[model samples]
Target: MNTVLTLMLVAPLLSAALAFAVRRHDQLRDALTLAGLGTAAGASGVMFATVAADGPFVLRVGGWHPELGIVLVADRFAALVLPVALAIIFVVELFAIGQRKTAWGSNPELSGPMMGVLTAGVSLAMLTGDLFTLFVAFELILVSSYVLLTHQGQAAQLRAGMTYVVMNLLASTLFLFGLAYVYAATGTVNLALLTERIPELPDGVRLGIGAWFFVVFGTKAAVFPLFSWLPDSYPTAPTTITAVFAGLLTKIGIYAMIRFHTLMGMDQLGNTMLIIAGVTMIVGALGALAQSHVKRILSFHIISQIGYMLMGLGLFTAAGTAGAILFLVHHMPVKTVLFLVGGLIENDQGTGRLDRTGGLARRRPLIAALFAVPALSLAGLPPFSGFVAKFAVISAGIEARATPWVVLALVAGALTLLSMTKIWLGVFWGADPDRVSVRRPPGNRPMMLAATGIAVAGTLTISALAGPLFDLSVDAAEDLRDPEIYRTAVLR
Candidate 1:
């Protein structure tokens, strides 16, 4: 089990090194990239299964003991998110293989190799059991994303990368300073140790530290006031890059918030989180309503949908937290596929502006069908994962007597459907961009469609398997609510 976890981390970095080493051979580089991501995804599945069957598996690097060594713990939450993260990277990597001409660059190896580094970073963020390791993993993700965002060498891309780079650096600084304060006050940075020590601190001290956690993670999660960086940045990158970032990156911040909320005993701050969650959803959805471009609309929805996840956390009950976890897992692939479908639209007509793209329904019925699944799913339509996930959150909110927030969520869901309707009508039915209908080109069309297929199928499968997944989420939520379980697993 330890070997599986370690391999999940090392395989990607090793493949990244190999990618650059054999950059001259495109076929070899592609093979290495695919194998690397596949290996990580496989290991993630094993880790999840092992944890489910035998409890968490932990490893201490350098034989330095838990306090001073590298601690990696694969508990239930880590098990769940890591596989999703790796699976996403795998799908995007495979899709990029057929899209190398413009989607990648003159050398596709550069972009694909960076993905390897990113997989390691995301895996580490999920698996590492300490603050410093988490910070380092975040830095790894940031570095790779900078390259990916600007891979096209376009001025717009560089500008977008610059914005992300500057803002993320500040976030990282805040995180470091916060970690320093946490360590200085508690004398240890290990998550398990902090879990034991945080609850023993004075109220004022705890409030101060918890506030820092909120701001630091709020920026990453794209929570309301702190989400200004997402909308513009996502649209400026390549579509696949945008899709990958949309799916996997922001969720890390949400994951951190989930991790520490219980460890730090965040009950005192529950009301404040609820307010933030409300504003985040409304603002994000309304922002989407105002957008003309498909990517920008989807980008705004990202912030809006995050509000739903935060709602779960703010309620902070077993059911509430479980609902939030389910929302997170459901949104990841659904959102990514939506963005990919948008990319396909942009590919067909050379624009994502709804006003510019019309009659796709008649021109490409299959593409429209593909878009409809995740679109309706994202809008909380029935029988899709979104509907089930939202039902959980709303039910939990009502149970907690959070009537106001639940009302706001209902309004936001309506607005979300409106936005989706606008896209459907404008892009698919409004007008045909060409004088005559045209089928999508052969190049990269199949690959892009296949990516969307995976996302849709996975989402529907989750919906079909909602009972088991909700059970898993309940277990994860319980583990989170009782940090003692996690602390004992790691410290023992």
Candidate 2:
């Protein structure tokens, strides 16, 4: 009777409905959104502790037979991930509570109700025990994101939304086909049951399904050859929306890939992700170097960072999975902090265009410091969360003797450093003849301050808690390496 997991899943949904009904009241909507997210955070934390203490918890919807019903799982990995996603969503929502003024009132771009559904969908995607249920969650997120993407009513945004919609629709279709394949082959859609049945299938069928899973998740993950949609779509959204998307969505896709590979006999696909990892990293880093806008640079870096996580998953060892988990945890905070700070810069400076900006360091040390900390961390500087993440990944790659991918990852890291340096020098380091400082409204500054402060603090806390956090990730990876643990928990 894991009440925490159940509440964590359902609260945001109820809150979403309530928030939408009262859309005319800005303060009420904000309060409802914050309250819902706060409750979800508390619930997810309790679930994490419960998972560690009591093992995996499963709830079968409607109390039907496992094969006939939907299921939600609160496993070691889900326990760890749900809170991270929720935290970012909360911070981004706080940021939006001010900047977003909809026709309704406060949520011009991302209404409180939409954010609630988005967070709920993320949690559901993490917790669902079957592909069909995950598909439903995906639909929820897709609908929420599309509305927000077109919020600005810009031609560029509309264009970006089309690409995003087309690609994800294709991915969703692939997910349905993949789900059908599993049901046809195994007679059950339950992940636990599939875990039990998959090993008996022919090797060719397994490989074909593996390929399909990659195409489906790779598009979602924004891995290369299917990656163009992300840089276009993400940068066009409102800053808060873009920050949330950068921090959570693609990580969910990577999470799906890692889970599928480890649990469902798609370890054969590890090498495929390995090749894609190196290419995605190099290409993305190069793209970051080419960008002048702060948002676009960060957008490209998302692709580059994903490659590092893929490297971890590709190695297919506990050490590798551990690296992936830690890197994922590390990247979420860093990415959110970067985007919040970037948006703050644009809000005050009249643009996020680096070429038009200068002299922030001398003029606004706080904003400068915010950017500098995560910037160095993003480049994998030591004593930061990013260092912990990158080292874990590179060490695992070296141990596996994946020399080519290792070299490419190192090169990507160097390029990440170079790109950050470019932004620093362009936007903050050099002298501005105008000597422009952050001149944002004092009222609006609270939102920027709150969002960036909380994000960077979380990033620092990751470093402070690295040993314990890394151990938790190791425990989660242990479960991934041995799916029998997951299977037994639900089936029994």
Q: Provide TM-scores for the models.
A: 0.97, 0.96
How far is 298's C-alpha from truth in model 2 (Å)?
A: 0.5
- The alpha-carbon lDDT assigned to residue 108 of candidate 1 equals 75
Give the deviation of candidate 2 from the true structure as CA RMSD.
2.1
Clashing pairs in 2: 101-108, 102-107, 102-108
Report every candidate's CA lDDT: 0.87, 0.85
> Residue 265 CA error for candidate 2 (Å)?
3.0
Q: Which digits, one per residue and each the tens of the lDDT, describe model 1 over residues 1-492?
A: 878988999999999999879977988998998899899999999888989999878888776777888899888888877888788888877667766664322237588899899999999998998989999999999899888888778887777778888888999999999998998899999988888888899988888999898998889899989998899799987777888899988999999898888666788888899999999999999999999999999999999999999999999888999999999889998998898888778777778888778999998898899899889989999989999899999999999999999999999999999999999998999767754322334356687678778877887888898888889988988888888898888888
Which residue pairs in model 1 clash with each other?
Answer: none
Off by over 4 Å in 1: 103-107, 434-442
Candidate 2: worst 10 consecutive residues by lDDT?
101-110
